[model samples]
Each structure stands twice: as C-alpha cells, then as structure tokens.
Target: MPKSLSNSYSNNTQPPFMLLIPQEEWQSLHEKLDRLTDMVEKTQRDSSNCDWLESEEARRLLGISPKTWQNYRDQRLIPFSQIGRKIYVNQADIDNFLLRHRIGEHR
Candidate 1:
C-alpha cells in the first residue's frame, strides 16, 4: 500500500465509469425521454386512470351521491380506504360491484 503504487492503481482504474453509446442508441434514448415527458404532461392535465380517482370521483362514476357512497362504505358493500380523514375507493371494487349485481344470468 505504498503511496506511489496506490496512485498508479488509481490512475489505471479508469474511474469505474463509462460513456459508451452508439448514435442510434442515443437517438432512441432521446425519443424515449420525449415520450415520457409528453406522457407526464398529459397525465398532469387529465388523469384518466382509475388509480387516480378519489372518493367523489368514484361515486360520480357509480352515478351515486357521496352520502350513498358513504352508506355503502359503512355497510362494507364496497371496498375503500381511510387515510386520516380522507376516504378513497378502489376502481376494481366498483367494477366488481357492478358485475356481481348485474342482471341477467349467462346463457
């Protein structure tokens, strides 16, 4: 572990890093980043994903009022979450409810 030997090893170690990239690969990376940026802006403007819906949104989707939704929640007929004072519902639960209570049996 002499200082000269250590210095030589450090100099020869190549910084443990790389910047290897073909022209096509760099273009592809740029394209991916641009698409990601566009998606982020679109999502910020209008999030259509059910995962982003709150309780009120979920109720609206069900064509019901907040009070009725609360009743359903209280009755445990629907799955929901309470974080502190905020209530939330899973879109899957809403879909499952519709399917389970739908009319007409299979042929």
Candidate 2:
C-alpha cells in the first residue's frame, strides 16, 4: 500500500473539503439573485393588480348559478366589462362586491 494511504487509514482521517469561490464572483452571484427576486416580485404584483376573471370564473367565485349571475348583470349589481362578446370582471371588483355585501356589525 502507498504510504499516504496507510497513513490515512491509520489516522482514520479524510481529505479536507474546500470550496474555492472568488469574492467578486460570490458577490456577483448574490447581486444576480437579488435582481431575479425583485423582478419576480414585481411580476407577481403586476399580475395581481390586473387579474381578470371570465363569466364562469366570476360565477364560481361568487358561488352563484348562471341564472343568478345573469340576473345580477341585468340588475347592474356587479361590476363587469365586456370585450367584443366576452365578459370579464376584475378581481378587485369582486373583492369590493364581497366587502360591500359582508354581513357584520360595523366597527
């Protein structure tokens, strides 16, 4: 056996683990990660700001039947928008509708 192998066996010691990364490279990696995180957060905020639900989705969200949904629209009880022949409701509008209809004592 090699002397080095014999010595390692006798001492029951393994080679030291080392990770070599330059300080500049490490800082650059962190900066890139921060930028990526910021971009992801901004995208999420932008998407949440403009969430548009279709008729079926709006009905499901409000727990109403198709007929009831149509009634609400005819009565102008819910906020909605129409593009061509398709209808869309903003999530914020749905949230506002829910808040307005909430059954509780005023604080």
Candidate 3:
C-alpha cells in the first residue's frame, strides 16, 4: 500500500512536505499525468539525429499560435520536449510537419 503524505510531521510548524489530495481529484491528476507521460515518451523516442529548436523559434517559423502548436503535439504531428517549463523540438520534425501539410508550391 502507498503511504499517505498527510502525516508529514506533527511537531514542526511548517513540515517539510504535506499533500492532501482528495480521492475525487486523483482521477483528474491521473489523466493529466498520463498525458504528460505520453508527451515525454514521444520526445524521448525522437531525440536523436536532428537540430533542436526552442518553442519560440518553432512557433515563429510556423507563424502559428501557441495553442495551435500545442494541438500539433497533442495530435502526434510533432515530437517535443519540456525542460523547466519551456518546450523544445527537433528542426527536422518541424520541417517534416510542414512538408506533410504543404498545400501550395512555388513556380
């Protein structure tokens, strides 16, 4: 059985750590964690042999809203990584995304 974090300390004024997650909230937390895990695995699997770009650079290159970029990742259209709250992506992934989505050609 897993130990509950609610009993961190009884003698300290500000116990090192304490968590009191309600049972109802566990499901929501579980779903969010599952999504995060999927994102992590996708990034890990594609982390080789490509130039990496920051989220800002990729968003600017694509000229799309942050939400759209997020949608792309959620839809498995791109692989990315999150480090300290910032996201990074491989240049080749972005290029392939564009090529797969090309709707016009230059003459």
Q: For residues 4-105, what per-residue lDDT tens digits would candidate 2 score against the true structure?
A: 766765456665677989999999999999999999999999988769999999999999999999999998888899999899998888898999999997
Error of 1 at 65 (Å): 1.4
lDDT tens digits by residue: candidate 1, 35-95:
9999998986764454545888888889998789879988999888889988887777888
What TM-score quantifies how close candidate 2 is to the native fold?
Answer: 0.54
Worst 10 residues of 3 by lDDT: 1-10
Candidate 3: misplaced stretches above 4 Å?
Answer: 1-50, 104-107
- List of clashing residue pairs for candidate 3: none
lDDT of 3 by residue, 11-98 (tens): 4555355688998799899999999999998887777534789988999999999999889889978899889988899888888989
Q: Report every candidate's CA lDDT.
A: 0.81, 0.89, 0.84
Q: Give the TM-score of candidate 1.
A: 0.49
Among all windows of 10 consecutive residues in model 1, the one with the lowest summed lDDT is 9-18
Better of 1 and 3 by lDDT: 3
